[model samples]
Target chain A: MAMDEAGGAPGAAKKFLYVNRKAPYGTIYALESLEVVLIGAAFEQDVQLAFLDDGVYQIVKNQSTDAIGAKNFSPTYKALGDYEVTKLYVEAEALEERGLTADDLMEITFEDEDDDWAEKPSINIVSRADMAKIMSEQDVILSF
Target chain B: MATLHTVNKSPFERSSFISALNHTVPGDKVLMIEDGVISARKGNTFADLVSSALSDCSVYVLAPDLAARGIAEGDLVEGVQTIDYGGFVDLVAECDRTQSWL
Candidate 1:
């Protein structure tokens, strides 16, 4: 097999990127997945998160859980930046459908440039086509 | 690319999943989770379609999901990899991308 600049296979070092498409709190899966990603960051692995479709609800600004008695967890996503998980992305179109803009989000910061998350990070997001390429390049992938 | 497609609902009840599978290229990995693992139970109709479409792909079920629903690995369609939470992490770590069909 041909080797790449990293001395591994062409795409061996990239960290795991998770695609979360479900509404948060509706099911335990999304929350659990986020927890796992947070743990991955502790190991210094690169982790990127993308919210599309109903998943955009997780990032919606000012979500009130008082009606449902659910302990407001939406704010926790904002704290992901504190974990150094800066590759936060939402589908350009999903945002429109949900009538959300960056203004409507909770300031979950992103890296200055696209791939600036880490020097040897294993996680990040790409466009849909690039997502496919990254998927092909990844050593592992998971969805929850 | 050995993509892992995790479906979380029944195939008939949740068409988004089948549609998601339609986008998958052959040899992709397909794992069932949450309510989606039910589709792989033996004698189920959805199992037939999944078996036909991604014959070359590896099929798997989350052990907790199957057990909670009163289904067993032995009750699943032949060849599905019944895995635990750690295995689930390994599965995510092994695939390049994951499309969750809700």
Candidate 2:
């Protein structure tokens, strides 16, 4: 297909979305994917980052990563704003079922997790259907 | 709108990959990486289902996985692309969204 002047599909802006569902540090794949997304953002692309399933662990609060000799990098997720990368989506049910709430999570505001995903918020919860909808609208996506 | 689905495990081992494939639209690409490459072998259900669902969408297997498994490239079914890390990156760049089925 044809990319428009904005580097998106014909005639409009493009959205680059990344999905992460794996636990933290289980493998380097998720981390590598995150780095790629960050690089993509550097190119001045619209980026949205989402976490689901086990991937929720990457943003959990009070992680004892020091025991594993890994730096507490979960905190860096909040720093994504420094790059002007504000789109952050999380699966609401994933956190609720896992006994986690925004208060229990690292200090962050989440969008509502609805399947419609109509309102595009900087940070919010998204239902699976909405996630799929957002994915369909994007010009590029990276999943880990 | 290209939807790239990444499957990282064998088919029988996990229905999540199959579920993901079932939900995929025509013209969407599927890349089998890590142990997921094993499903590309002929006679596997995943190999058959993918071919039937998408004739145009590209299917690929990671080169390292095939090399480590000692499976010759020529042994795989027709139309499956074998790519390295860079080609994989290209897929990431080209698609609109990617989902990992593990």
Candidate 3:
């Protein structure tokens, strides 16, 4: 595989890791961070998203923004596949700490174009140590 | 290469400001935005830390964030430069990487 240089020619896709540590709502970080990810998809970069700490709550099922008067954007995660962003790493420790399980998260998937449009799960449950290693290997780390 | 350190929380509300300051190296640039702009104001408790950091690194405050909070240019601490959103983009481009202290 050819490696892409930073801000270089086309096809030069740099690895972009977006770290989310904040929960959705109460603050604009989570929503704004998603906006950046969506916009960055245009660059065709190798994108990876990590959800840890309070950020794990973002993918929880049945989030109702009706009472809070906020637009429910949790569904956006399901749309990430269309943008070619399918890597969503959820920290196992974070989920356990919050008393959540993989089953509690929303079903987010992407169509594998190369695999004959097969539907694939986007979420990858990983240990904290594994996530840390992944973070160390990224070309760029954008945290929120 | 210098890192662009961004802090979005207020020092009065969180210790993110102090943590960001402690982690920053001599050549790094600290850009205060959102509620973090509160720490850039003059005569505040964190004024000393901001002033001290200025001697070794560049300190900046987002103009729009300051204006949004009614913090005038004159209210900024000494040696702290104020930059607009365009400047923020430029800073990100100029630095090796960005570290946001949430």
Cα lDDT listed for each candidate: 0.68, 0.71, 0.88
TM for every model, in the order presented, reads 0.57, 0.61, 0.62
Candidate 3 lDDT tens digits, B1-102: 677889999999987687567656667899999999999999999999999999889999999999999999999999999999999999999986787878
| Tens-place lDDT digits, model 1, residues A1-144 | 121332355544456667677777788867887888888877665566766556777777788989987777876776676787877656655566667665676665544444665443212323444444444454445565
Off-target runs (Cα >4 Å) in candidate 2 are: A1-13, A96-103, A109-122, B12-102
DockQ ranking, best first: 2, 1, 3
lDDT score, candidate 1: 0.68
Model 1 C-alpha lDDT per residue in residues B1-102, reported as the tens digit of each score: 467777878766766566455546667778888888888888988777667754767888899999999997788887777999999899878875666665
Give me the candidate number with maximum TM-score. 3
User: What overall lDDT, based on C-alpha atoms, would model 2 receive against the true structure?
Assistant: 0.71
Model 1 chain A: weakest 10-residue lDDT segment is: A118-127
Worst 10 residues of 3 chain B by lDDT: B18-27
User: In model 3 chain A, where is the ten-residue run with the lowest total lDDT?
Assistant: A1-10
Clashes of each: 12, 9, 0
DockQ of 2: 0.35
1 or 2, greater by TM-score:
2
